[model samples]
Target chain A: SAVISQKPSRDICQRGTSLTIQCQVDSQVTMMFWYRQQPGQSLTLIATANQGSEATYESGFVIDKFPISRPNLTFSTLTVSNMSPEDSSIYLCSVAGQGVGTQYFGPGTRLLVL
Target chain B: AQRVTQPEKLLSVFKGAPVELKCNYSYSGSPELFWYVQYSRQRLQLLLRHISRESIKGFTADLNKGETSFHLKKPFAQEEDSAMYYCALRGTGGYSTLTFGKGTMLLVSP
Candidate 1:
């Protein structure tokens, strides 16, 4: 399993503002996933960030609203643009294990949109 | 559509008592099952996976493909085992993204 360091563990943002969350892995990884866990809601996949290319967004999620960046194999970022109150949620980054699809998640970034 | 269902939103039990958390899934193909735990203020971590067939902290889950279920069970519940448990399934979808259930909160009392 790989270790992920996520910054801005918790944040308070205003409506229409954007927040960029960063995830840095200790070692190179092939795939990095982004998920959003809203209050009292199940975790939902936002996108898959592939190294050196644009992210592949999930259904109902677009790159314009939830843009992603994977500059290298060890780092990725997700930006929530034009945020609204409904965007308040815990955003997490995960890395898949080698030889298996088991993923290890980071201590999520809790965002409160006001 | 792929989905994972955990019937119980909350489960309570006393120490030394047996415990079982039910989970069911709906997918067209065979899916890998997993249990994830989140302790107070901690990150969501994997507890066990059906493929591994291994027990961690005395917890195990058997995948019953015939029933389309994977229920986590432990012989004797401990206070430290209290946490939010989520049942997830990895289907044949692209990238095998995990589809998680709305977790169940377990409380083990003395």
Candidate 2:
């Protein structure tokens, strides 16, 4: 098990503004991921953030809209650019445990775009 | 493409009653399934995984390859069990991303 935390637990941003959510892990991990959860809905993978490399984004999500940076094994950030009402969702960071499929998630950053 | 389907959006059960949250997946190769829970105002946490075959907090999930399903079950529900539950599937090999199902909201009433 791993402990993870996120910054700006909750925020309200005006439309067209941008916000970057930070994710920190207690231990060094090779694979980190970003996810989005719409209001009363399921989780959607945004991208895979690996240290010192370009992030692999999922379908329907582009780097221009949701850019990710994994500078090191223990830290990553996801920035929601040009935010809109539809982009308002709970953003989460997760790290995969070594040699297993289990993933540990961080406390989500809830963003409300007005 | 790998996908997970959780048929029920909401499940309401009485305290001490049996509870089951259905989850099915679509994958070509061997599937690794997991159950994640998010209590109100808390972050999502892994509850159990099929590969581990271990029960956590009185909750267990059995993977049925024939049915391509991994359903979560609890013999006696507790009031604190009320939370949003998500079924996730991992792609084959290390570093594969996870695909999550539309979560099921379990409401265990007192």
Candidate 3:
């Protein structure tokens, strides 16, 4: 498993503001993903962070709302733009490990939109 | 689309009793399944994977393609095993993002 760390473990932000969450891995990984878990809901895929390219978002997600930056193999950032109370959730980052389907996740960023 | 289904929202069991967490999947391609666990105040972690075919922490799961199920089981439950368990499925690819089911909160009482 990879050791992953996320910055701003938690933060409360005002609605319409944006907050950027950072994820760093101890070693370079081939894949990195961002997920969100809303209150009483399962984890939802936000997007897949691709190095040197725009992230590929899921059907219900858009880059304009959640912009992702993968500057390198070991680091990525996800910004929740124009946040709302509905966006209050725990955002997590995960990296693919050496084995197939082994995804080690970082401690999630708890975002509370006020 | 690949999807995982964990029917039980919560499972309560007594220590030393048997435990089983049901998981089902809907996928057309070959499925890679995983069981993830999260302790209170801790990050999510992989408990085991179907491909490994190995028991972890006294827990074991067998994939049944015909049934499309991978149920986690343990002969004896422990109080410390109480936590949230998630079943995930990955599409056949190099870096396919995992599709997770609604987690089952296991509560093992002494």
**Considering only N, C-alpha and C atoms within 3 Å, which residue pairs clash in candidate 3?**
none
What residue pairs clash in candidate 1, if any at all? none
Better of 2 and 3 by DockQ: 3
TM-score of 3: 0.96
C-alpha positional error of residue A49 in candidate 3 after TM-score superposition, expressed in Å? 1.1
Mind giving the per-residue lDDT tens digits that candidate 2 earns over B1-110? 99999999999999999999999999999898999899998878888889889999999999999999999999999999999999999875457578899999999999
DockQ for the candidates, in order: 0.77, 0.73, 0.81
Q: lDDT tens string, model 1, B1-110? A: 88999999999999999999999999888788999999998888889889999999999999998999999999999999999999999856567578999999999999
Off by over 4 Å in 3: none
True contacts kept of 2: 0.72
| TM-score of chain A for the candidates in order shown | 0.97, 0.97, 0.97
User: For residues A25-101, what per-residue lDDT tens digits would candidate 2 score against the true structure?
Assistant: 99999999999999877889899888989999888999999989898999999999999999999999999885466
Candidate 3 chain B weakest lDDT stretch, 10 residues: B90-99
Looking at model 2, the pairs that clash are none
Report model 3's chain A TM-score: 0.97
